[model samples]
Target: MTLRHAVLAALLDGDMSGYQLAKTFDVSVSNYWHALPQQLYGELTKLEKEGLITGRVVIQQGRPNKRLFSLADPGTETLTQFITEPSRPSFIRDDLLVKVRACEVGGHAELIEQLEERAVQARAKITLFDKLLRELRGGTDEETYLASNSRIGPYLTGLRGRAFETETLLWCEQSARVLRLRIGSKPANG
Candidate 1:
């Protein structure tokens, strides 16, 4: 999917300044789609020019003016159409995966280190996603929140993010363990 679609979908929540959009993407959208702040700013300009998103300048004392953006009619229509289109299947293109595939040739130590590092990263994200999900649910249990909340898209995506990280942590640990075993070495920290 294009960044256009991601930006449009993000604006679905409400009007947001470019900075706010960037923060939102960093916390939530980064789960499914990744974009740098500069990329988001550029796409915002393009979307505004194309009339897919509406932007209004907000003046503030002691600060530069900021443009707040919201989804226009065309933007909503674009997102709707995008939703109806078949999504291309997602695939892994991770460099770590490639290295693991070739591990038999050499570099078991490096590969194991990389895998353990990835596991740590995944654990961090899982903790973050857990906190985010709790905040999104707002003291409600997941079932109740899902049933009662109208704006559950973010929560749903956060759930997916947590699950993804959890799986990543598991896979990384498993891969590391297998490599260590093959090399007749004890697992890291054990």
Candidate 2:
């Protein structure tokens, strides 16, 4: 999906300034779709120009005025249309996977180290997602929250991210173990 759709999804929560939206994306949307702050700001302008979203300037004391954006009727309609269309299949284009493939060309040790580091990163993401899940739950039990929350899209996407990271951690650990075993058993010089 385009960043446009992601930004629309974010606005569903409520109207927010570009800064606020960027911060929200970092904590929430960054899990499923990564976009830099600059990219989000750019998209906000595009969306405004397209009339899909509306922005209003808010003055703040001792601070520059900021524009807050909210999804317009057209935006909601566009998002509905987008949801109906079949999504193209997703694929990984990861450098780490390329390195894994190249291990046979002589970087086994380095590759293994990289895999371990990736596992750590994955674990950190999982922890952050867990915290987000808790906040979304807001003291409500999972079943209650699922049944009651008007905006469940974020929660659903968050769950997907958590699962993805969890699986990534498992895969990295398994790959590292296999590589270590192979390296350990190999002849000293062959």
Candidate 3:
């Protein structure tokens, strides 16, 4: 998906300045679509020019004025059209995965180190997703919230992110353990 679609989906949360949108992306949206602040700003400008989004200037007492954006009718229509279209399948293109594939040829130590590092990152993300999911559900239990909440899209996506990270953590830990065990079997001077 394009940054345009990600930005549009984010605006569904509410009106937000570019800064606020960047923060939102860092916290929640980054789980799916990754974009730098500059890219997001550029996409916001393009969306506004295309009439997909509207922005209003908010004046602050001491700081610089900010522009808050909201999705327009055309944006909503665009999203509807997008959702109806078939999505291309996603493929893994990670460097670590490539390294793991080559690990059988050698470099087990490096691969094991990278895998352990990835596991740490995954754990951090899982913690963050857990906190976000809790906040999204408020005091309601997940099942109750899923069934009764007015807005469930974000929550559902958050669940996917959490699950993805959980799998990542598990795989990384298992791979690292296997690699570490294999290290003991290597020849003394080979």
Candidate 4:
């Protein structure tokens, strides 16, 4: 998807400054997609010029003036069109996977180490996803927003993120076990 769509979908929750959008991505959307703050600022400008998003400058005492942005009608239309269109087939282009395949004949140990490190990263992200899911579940003392967002794209995206991370953690553990077996080490669990 284009950065335009990413930014627009992000703004679907409501208006936000660029800083707020960056933080939102870090907390929610950073798992499947990523954009630098500079990229976000640039995209916001382009989106505004295209009439997809509009921003209002807000003054703050301790910080630079922030431009709070929200979707215009055109932005919503664009997002609707983008979402309704059929998605392209997914493809894998992971350089690390390719590297591991090539190195399998030379020294699987290094590949094992790389994959193990990836496991750590994936596990950490899974913890974040779990937190997001719990947050999605809402609170007894506070209102939950995700229920209201059931029809929104991020609602579905959150499910997909959970599934993907679960598969990643499973694959990591299994791959590590298989590599250990190859090296004449007992399975980590066995």
**Tens digit per residue, CA lDDT, model 2, 1-190:** 9999999989999999999998999887887789999999999999999999999999999999989999999999999999999999988778998888878888888788888899989999999999999999999988999999988888898899999999999999888888989888432222
* Tens digits of lDDT, candidate 1, 1-190: 9999999999999999999999999988988899999999999999999999999999999999988999999999999999999999988778998998899999998899899999988989999999999998888999999999999988888998999999999999999999998998876767
Q: Cα lDDT for residue 163, model 1?
A: 92
Return the TM-score for candidate 3, rounded to 2 decimals. Answer: 0.95
Q: How close is candidate 1 to the true structure, as a TM-score?
A: 0.95
Q: Which candidate, 3 or 4, would have the higher TM-score against the true structure?
A: 3
- Residue 183 displacement (Å), model 3: 0.4
Model 3 C-alpha lDDT per residue in residues 1-190, reported as the tens digit of each score: 8999999999999999999999999999998899999999999999999999999998999999999999999999999999999999987678998888888899887777788888889999999999999999999999999999999999999999999999999999888878878787432223
Worst window of 10 by summed lDDT in candidate 3: 181-190
| Candidate 4 residue lDDT tens string, 106-179 | 66776677777777877787787777666655562213454454544665677778787778778777777777
Over all chains combined, what TM-score does candidate 4 have? 0.86
Flag clash pairs in model 2.
none
Question: Which stretches of model 2 miss by more than 4 angstroms?
Answer: 185-190
